[model samples]
Target chain A: MSVTSTTSQPNYHILSVLVQNRSGVLARVAGLFARRGYNIFSLAVAPTEDDALSRITIVVDVESTPLEQIVKQLFKLIEVVKISELDPRRSVERELLLATVRATCDDRGQVVELANIFEGKILAVGADAITVSLDGHPDKLDDFEELLRGYGIVELQRTGRVALPKLDREARLRAVKGKVV
Target chain B: MKMTGAQALIKALEMEGTEVMFGLPGGCILPAYDPLLDSSIRHILVRHEQGAGHMAEGYAHVTGRPGVAMVTSGPAATNMVTPLCDAYMDSIPMVCITGQVPTSAIGTDAFQECDTVGITRSVTKHNELVMSAQDLPLAIRQAFHIATTGRPGPTLIDIPKDVLQNSMEWHWPTDAEVIDSLPGYRPTMKGHPRMIKEAARLILESERPILYVGGGVLKARAAEALLELAELTNIHVVTTLMARGAFPDSHPLCLGMPGMHGTASAITAMQQSDLLVALGARFDDRITGKVSSFAQQAKIIHVDIDPAEQGKVRRPDVPIVGDCRLVIEEIVKAIRELLATGSTQADTSVWKSRISGWREQFPLSYEPSEPGEALKPQFCLEALRDSAPPDTILVSGVGQHQMWSSQYWRFDKPYTWVNSGGLGTMGFSVPAAIGAKVGRPEATVWAIDGDGCFQMTAQELVTASTERIPVKVAILNNSYLGMVRQWQEMFYEERYSEVYLSPDTPDFVKWAEAMGCVGIRVDSPEEVQPAIDRANSIDDRPVVVDFRVAASEKVFPMVPAGFGNDDLLLPPSQMARKEFLR
Candidate 1:
């Protein structure tokens, strides 16, 4: 709901930008970042509950750009409806990871147990490799991928990160949208 | 009625009340030009696409409407990029229609094809590539709506050739439908009342305050409100180059331009002020020489239509996002309400005294040329200013002449001063002047260009001549790229690298004659006034006056490249004193 500053600096800040669901909206959004020279770490886009609108979850590194400016420029984009920062403390973020791990039949049980412990699923079973898919918080996904790496992973893919503000009303509410820093 | 997309496009332009447009015919745009033959709209065929674009800008500047410029795909569209970017930077309301390649040929490198929508996405406020004949009218409508609205800017509609060739039933949407179509695009008309009250309170509390005006005031047509605020608050106004005539220059509270090449008085006043009510002026780098060192003592009340511009450079204490005129009007009302509650206007007598003293200390000046020496460019401009009517629209190309035009002219009216400000585009004057002339046919338009700028786009004079626009051109032909030469002399140790543009090679007077314009040459002090007078007398054709000026002159009171405004460098003779350094 708000961008509350933390003592520790974050390498990347996530922004959930609600935009009009129009053709070429993605290119327009991505083009804005490129035009302004804003470093975009990763982006995930999908239609929201309303079919007319889409939320583009952007992970942007604000080392050079002031976060306020990035948000302000986004507001200028014609299709951008609303921009809200997903503060690390007050937002839930998740990423989907699909990996093909190198494992022998003897090590298959260990890999499957690791996947189960991380809430992952075995999609395919090969002679020496097992394909696993995991959906969880990006950090948990990272840990799961690391465990699979020891089993000699052949391929890996992460679906960037998608986020939503934590719906706890009693807690602190600091709205920074359209606010000048 | 069923009509081709090309017919619909022309009909849409007519519906938008387009009186004139400047453009050229080419492969893709040829179809639209065909329907144009039946429309009542006047189309001025320009020599180059850049000229067409700039001409539209000039027209918009005078008319306060979105100017239209059309060009074919690829190279022609690319040529319009400068003017589109120029209009975008200055926030001129313009709709540039580019004839794109056929929808099927797009992204496949068809002959005369281009990714115009992709290329201009950043430079334009909004751009759409019309894919279907049915979408043409709505797209054109959207283009104008987006272009002329909030924080007005250049918008483009790229129509594929096939879309134009295809036919569909004409459907002109109502104004409400146009508004409903772009739900994400609504401009804030009024400032938040609380912020308005806070801004008014600041004006009441602050002793040393100044209204820092920019082009936004002009864009909003809020000069009267700005004038009211300044008078009511008794604050001196520093109009940036872009906002030259937004506040009358002859007003007692007016302090000419501020920033690099700005008046020393304006620069010092800004640095010394306690509160700066910045209306529509983004704190550009040229204005804020060193961002960290700029206006350290001032509290900012920044009002702009674009919320992004509020704190883009300096964090404002009170940031109001709304139309400039509307916010200023609200502030005026708030000030009156507060004053009724026993609050008094802040006294600014002592500040006025200091402003007057500074103005006297370093008035804009130039060394006079004797009978034998070439006329001073500043002197020539002064003559033109005196010889021309007070209402004459003055346009200038970028460089020394632009700075001088801003400095020398006494503009008392809004929309009288037009130039390429944000983009600093050279060769903007000729075509822009033509456009301005076309927009306001009764008023005389003079394009004050430098030798360097004139050579770049003087061919537009042929358009003016054939079209009988009767716009006058005064080229300060100093035989060199004067501004560059001045910088080289001052900064690069006088090693004038490629700056020496031979004075006599193309003979501007003869060149003007060749273009069917009345060409006059003047090199003496006495001849300057006569030349301008003669040019003013000619109404049948465009006039080109080549005033050979002294090449050594430099625009002064300059804030050097890296230094802060506090460290202003006056003329070379006064550099040692540093008396202006506050």
Candidate 2:
């Protein structure tokens, strides 16, 4: 995959690293980022279908050093098997965000209507607060969170971004058009 | 069949072809020591854990094998931090096995227990704590594999006490099994043909090109291939400090070393070159001086095994990631094709004359000693070079002595010059010299050390004397931390802060004698050659010769810290102009 041309302003980039599912591998990867003074905007890690391997998705804001250097350093980790830089433009990105917001009698209806508009579900409703969950693109989740803050968010949690490359044009057209053969 | 974890560890080391290890035993490592009694591998008991680590580094530097060191938990493991960092900086292949407390007692702060893996994680290429007896073999195997492959560095395996004592069923696995298991470690051995061709094109088209070789050339055993390319292209070559022996110094096109204290000719040539063909050499701060200005005119073609090092410092116009030997071979082949088709002809007569002019104008020289005056350190080094065998391996500690030795000694072959280049580690010479001697038993080994650095690890001579390693140490006893003193003289307005190593403080001759070594002291200029000859003749035990050289002498053609190579200062006699700037 190609790294996009560097712009004057710093931009966030996502790196998906596949590594051995063993103790201290995550720490080693994180330690490398910390030692190199690279800022990690968000980090998500979990095991893959193969029990022996794990996938770590890290979003870093590039400031000084090139993304090529960061990827090379990640490859230096003995546990890291493969690293793929997911271009935001070419990949489908999603994040799961959960928020507990104050929803008293007056604001309950407004909050519910906003949640419904964002395709969010109410997980639990309490006397003072209601817990709402939404799964969508990172920017969509950010927009939903901004609306929820109007009702006074008591707590907020976000499962960083996970990405998968978009299908080829033929497959996308077939899937979108709902055509067999 | 069943075997104890310690026995399995020993068996695994044997399977990896480990013939020797340097270590010091303590309470936690005692279990591993017991199994060593029946093992075939020779263990050299070092005075300190640090000594053990450096000795292993020395051995690894000479032979392209991963040197092994074993130390106990806590303080013993802590002592290995210096050498671990040293090995990491230089990318030396080494495996350090540290003993740990029982697995159950790992977090409880048991006696002589510490976070071995945590402590070494940043410094080592990789580290593992073996929590189970069954995992010991695989961990040991993985450690060796990781330590020796791709840009090689030190790896540590911490075996808990109980893990070593516990017994388990064991079977020796074939090489294929080990190979299949390590999926994450695949080192690219072949260069991309396109990149190789592009590099060759750059080399052929450039008017002023220089082959900037580094330690990776020696690591990849690509010296012959590199020399062939240099000769074919009719280009001058500069070997970095870590790459002293990578190219023969006697070659007509060879520009000795280029960097902080590099030869003026080499530095100037690099600064003036239009293209820099950097093979396996990182543009280290010491070599580059000021990053932005270093080789500003040169278009770089960097070929290294580690992709991380490609753009880590200076960006290369053509970056090829592969083994040095393979890449050089491909480049040579591509050049041959180009020559066959008459695509390009490398005619660098103008560049050659400019470099030769610099070589003649600023030759490496020292001030002659006045009648009956104290001997100069450079004179002692020159004498040693003349007296010693052609194959003698010269290892040195960091300081003025290291720079002087690198400047004066004419290394004819690869693997003959060993020193701590990246880390600038003091006290590295004595133990490293012993290790080099151990690795190359037929070749005479000498540790040319400074007085201040010699004092730091002089006790390792006991191990050398007792073990009959027969490595000679020549101490340039200038009564000061000479390199620092020189810097202080030049930059710090001659404020010599704590740099003076007093003459009467634990006399080196008496100390060497106490350590059961042949101690010889040379005071005058006349005694330098005789002392080196006498020391060279002794083969039964290690020798320490204290040469009281002139303290005021300084290494010249120095690019002060943060200065460009073009701004090098020549010696007073060689300086026609005060400040020589490009």
Candidate 3:
């Protein structure tokens, strides 16, 4: 059943979840979103500095579910240690995209030139194709993928966005001013 | 000290103060069962894993603690899915431990192996598969903590056999060890002072106010505070089916149950009210038929512990997320302060009289059977209520008999009425009653079941009889799934397809006797009270009284599934009257 709203415009929500680094924890977290019918637009997971803990960043559309409901549901999982909603405006968001396009001998140099224009690196060179990698904000990566699609892209993959909250500038300035000699 | 994982699990459960468990043993769980024999905790072997799960739920329902259930891998875990879902739906605190194949054999299609964690994850509040024996203690501790705290629900810990057999250094962890590990599970207990004050103001300003109580009040042990608020404000209270015993049925302001089979007065009062003080109650579709029209005129002040439940079904004007007991206490205090400051006085006498008029005009009534006729289920329930002790805990299986019992029995105290409210599991009564009896040995417990429901889990009676729990089981033997039959009769052109059960197959009394329970069958109206009395008098063993109630009896004052609350259908006698529709 659709909970909360039906007519409201969907807003993007980025939730950073800290969980125990154990087998099946990721599956349990993903299963919660799937079972609740909440669409996960993007997700990234990596072990935290502490080996015992793992951090997962998820981007979801909050049209059918309220943010409070999603957070509460996430908290219900015992393996989930902590969850914080990252404000998109105050967080650094990045995505990595890798694509392989069919590059004939004549167009291989052209492909390299185009990759340079987009700040992309050539990861691998095949007989008829070159794999290019790009890392930037999701929008930039989207732009890069759109430009490459014209080259008859043979393969494409994108890592969902991962984000970190930026330190508050005002608070950091005040802390710096209040620093002890 | 070093101990095997299974031994450490037993020790952990003991530290958690788990006195009893319900389970059945299997190959994967054999090692755990071996340790159980030496542990102080008593294990009641169940015929089915589902029975074990429900028994734990029943135990938890009464004790306000997490009930523990254990079963092996594969089919055993699959059998437990229903009870887990049932407990999850009702938000009952339960811990289910399932044995798994050895760690190396997890994905090899080993004997009696299944993905216990994967299967139970959606049904449980949380679940885990122990990768190491060292994690067992913390996992069990976390299971108990998660199960009991923050909107209680079932949690599972799947243990592979090798892990249970492996040795680990064991020590009982301090409170800090357990609490420090769980960083994200803090539940807000105190309602915001500003919201409490606003709720009080709304209640004071309401001309026709009703307090809508749900199962959360009982779960939070806030019934006394709820009663205090109702009596102090003179506001009428309508307890939903799950909240049957939350308010005294005999109270002047109590409007009985308000839902599908709710009393006419209760349904009408809710429909006509200007304001609703909803305490720990979610506006479930069962309680609020046709959500758009339910309490349309009422400005709701919804108080519950779970924030997700705030606007899940019905958005409240004022939503307070906190523990029910603490929130209700705050509301009572705020109301008292308001009265002292001359801000408001209880001036709902006019609205109160209108409710009283409704109560008198459309009381819950059933036709009394003629002499030597088949007994009415309502009559049997009333007789059972009269004969059973006042403090007796009434457990019910689902269907028409459940509604009839909820409608007819007058519950005066909280925790005395236990039934499957959200899931409405059919075979919940017998095992749950046994669990209730085990939890509260001093109190009398009765499993008021139906013929169809009794057949589903009647074998649990053998466990009760063998354990000497002495719970009473009253079968309202109507020879049909009466609720379905009633719906068919009313809405399906009387096409009773598969609703009817043959009377000759496995008579309930004979089945009860076979299980070593004191079996008594009553066919006539006069035999109803006598049978109940006989059942009540038996203390050494469990008693089963089969009252052959009217097969065609129907539950009245139904809102008819998807219909609006205002479209309540009264009893057949009043069905033709158009005036009562309003």
Candidate 4:
């Protein structure tokens, strides 16, 4: 089946969910996503940027309906208190952070120049190498990293994903209202 | 309240809730054996130590509990190595207890001192040489905890003679302390639903997706859940050697076993798929062939119970570690949601067409009429699978039959196919099946052995018959050592030496009957089924079906040694059909 997208590139998606912290629960959820062949962009889970619940923000490449189903399943877990898509259209701001370099002395200057243009900092420096770090939308960081790789690359590391919804209080009240209705 | 080390061990095992054990007594372990005599534990005195080891594996596989095997130190303990290696490779949970030379006499080259712990480290999940009475309880408790947790495997506790006699307070911990302390014991559950949904989207969007099922499905008892996901998504299923019959091989969507000697359809389909979802099975070298060309086109999603398995081989696009059953159930839920929202469907017609062509082109072939001259190994494996109970546990010794059994047996449940998959130890099945039969007396068990292998552990037959364990023994009695012979035939130009037994072979039938067991010899091809039926008829005595199969017969659908799946050799007859089908 065709993806039916007129765009030349593949579609990408991002989602946030609240889950109950329990043994074997993470395995179940991650296993589910994996079994279906979904490629995860980034996944971060920690005590909420807000409530007592655990907030799990995941970036994936897919359409809308599957994301909703995932949230519904998350809600079914007794420990999970809430889940949301964290719409990028209305959210404040989020970024993907990466550290990578072409570990060679000759191309080190070129790598540093690109990192500076991306509003990134050089995290490490060596006689034959340099490490640059950047935080931004995943697409932007990926583009910057790709540009660096043209030089003989040496190492790479990434903080897969993190997100905070902009509609903090209003979204909570609306979620409560939706639950009641 | 002070207790001896032997007493502490007994108390610890009792605390871990051991109800029964299989063992034999010997001089090195006289002190521990003395305590065992009076303990409430019901010890089945197997005729041989090796029998005790395999009986323990059998029991564990059936009961889903760790089976205990107790034996004296030195040679007795070493005798159990084959069985322990079998459980290690197949991931069965068991506790093998060996009594050693007294601690005071250790490292002095004392009589019956064989370094049981050192010898078994690689063959077990964890092993301990308990030196002090105080450490006895903790060590035994740890052995049980480690043996039954995660991807369960055998564990050993070697009790030195002096330590078994040393005094210490006997206190059974109400809670299993070692279980609480296990650092790597955490099992994963469901992943983020959002990720699962996206995976569902990937499944729906892909034109060619393959489902690579593994032993995790059987371990999690997730067969039904996996089948549901496969049917909904319309993806084909291929299993690893350890994961035979996770989905019924007879089903249309099933692609059969994939790897060296796997169905041509399955391997070709895997090579062509763009997205391969691997569940439970680790990508072993045998399964992956040449890593560079294996699943080169497929974006993989790996779901497994062990985290270390996730990126250890070929990296996965999505690495989800958890129980296979729960993971699959959640995937099905996500797919249902996608369908409601009008997501795309998988067009698997091209994949199926290509696989069907491969199947017809080189269908699993065994010479039907080659007579006593060409008794293919597959015929024997197929006969055993067809004749045994659907739920019968088929334990195999290492070599040609081990791989062939993996290729042929349609196993649908856990514990059904027990072989030393990674170790490839010969003389494993006979003892392992004995352990399995002891573990689950209700289930049928068969030790599918080769003549060369059965002789290694044949002493266990006396134990089986004495214990009233009616384990059927089907010997593929090809006079030559089959796998080694195949190498000689293909690579060494039939320069046969050492691979063949001397002209006069021992009478296996009379030997079994001598041990108070039933024995049947099949001299002709027509007697195969009847002998199997007769062997199945025995209730209290073990039966041996020694099929005098052709000595020159070789296992085919061959993947020449040290090569990947692409270089598989079809029998000259079948190679011609590849062009005809095209």
DockQ of each: 0.58, 0.71, 0.54, 0.02
Model 2 Cα lDDT, one tens digit per residue, B1-582: 798999988888988999999999998888899889999999999999999999999999988888999999999999999999999999999999999998888899899989989889999998999888788888888889889988899999999999999998887766677777777888888998999999989899999998999999999999999889988888999999999988899999888999998988888889888999999999998889899889899999999999898989999999999999999999999999998998876678878887888887788888889998878999999899999887999999999999999999998899999999988899999989988888998999999999989988989999998888999999999999999999999999999999988976778899999999999999998787788889999999999999998889999879999887777888988777534323
* lDDT digits (tens) for residues A53-134 of candidate 3: 9999998888767777788778867678888998888888888889999998889998899899989999999999999999
- After superposing candidate 4 on the true structure, give the runs of residues whose Cα lies further than 4 Å from its correct spot: A1-181, B1-3, B38-40, B174-176, B183-198, B370-377, B380-384, B412-414, B579-582
Query: Model 2 reaches what TM-score against the true structure?
Result: 0.95
Would you list the C-alpha lDDT of every candidate in the order shown? 0.90, 0.89, 0.88, 0.74
Model 1 TM-score on a 0 to 1 scale: 0.95
Across all candidates, the chain A TM-score values are: 0.85, 0.88, 0.86, 0.71
Say which candidate scores most in DockQ. 2
Give RMSD (Å) of candidate 3 vs. truth.
3.2
What clash pairs does model 2 have? none
* Span of ten consecutive residues with least summed lDDT in model 4 chain B: B179-188
* Cα-based lDDT at residue B201, candidate 4: 79
Task: Please give, for residues B1-582, the per-residue lDDT of candidate 3 as tens digits.
Answer: 999999998999998999999999999888899888888999999888899999999999988888999999999999999899999989899999999999999999998888888998899988888988899999999899889887889999999999999999997767689888776667788999999999999999999999999988988999899889988988999999889989999999899999888998898888889998888789988889999999898898999888888888888899999999999999999998998998876578888788988887788888888877788888888888888786999999999989988999999988888899999999999999999999999999999999999999989999988889899999888899889999999899999989989775777778889899989989888777777788888899999988888898889989899999888889877667627534
Please state the error at residue B554 of candidate 1 in Å.
Answer: 0.8
Q: Candidate 4 on A13-74: residue-level lDDT in tens?
A: 55676664534345545654664455566677777544445667776666633554455434
Ranking by DockQ: 2, 1, 3, 4
Question: What TM-score would every model get versus the actual structure?
Answer: 0.95, 0.95, 0.95, 0.72
Candidate 1 structure quality by residue, lDDT tens digits, B1-582: 999999999999999999899999999988999999999999999999999999999999999999999999999999999999999999999999999888888889999888888888888999988899999888999999899989999999999999999999999988999888777788888899999999999989898898999999999999999999888878899999999999998999998999999988899899899999999999999898999999999999999999889788999999999999999999999999999999987787887788888887777877777768778888888888888886999999999999999999999999999999999999999999999999999999999999889999999999999998999999998888988998999899999999998979898889999999999999788787777878888999999998888899899889988889998888776667567446
Query: Between the candidate structures 1 and 2, which one is better when assessed by lDDT?
Result: 1
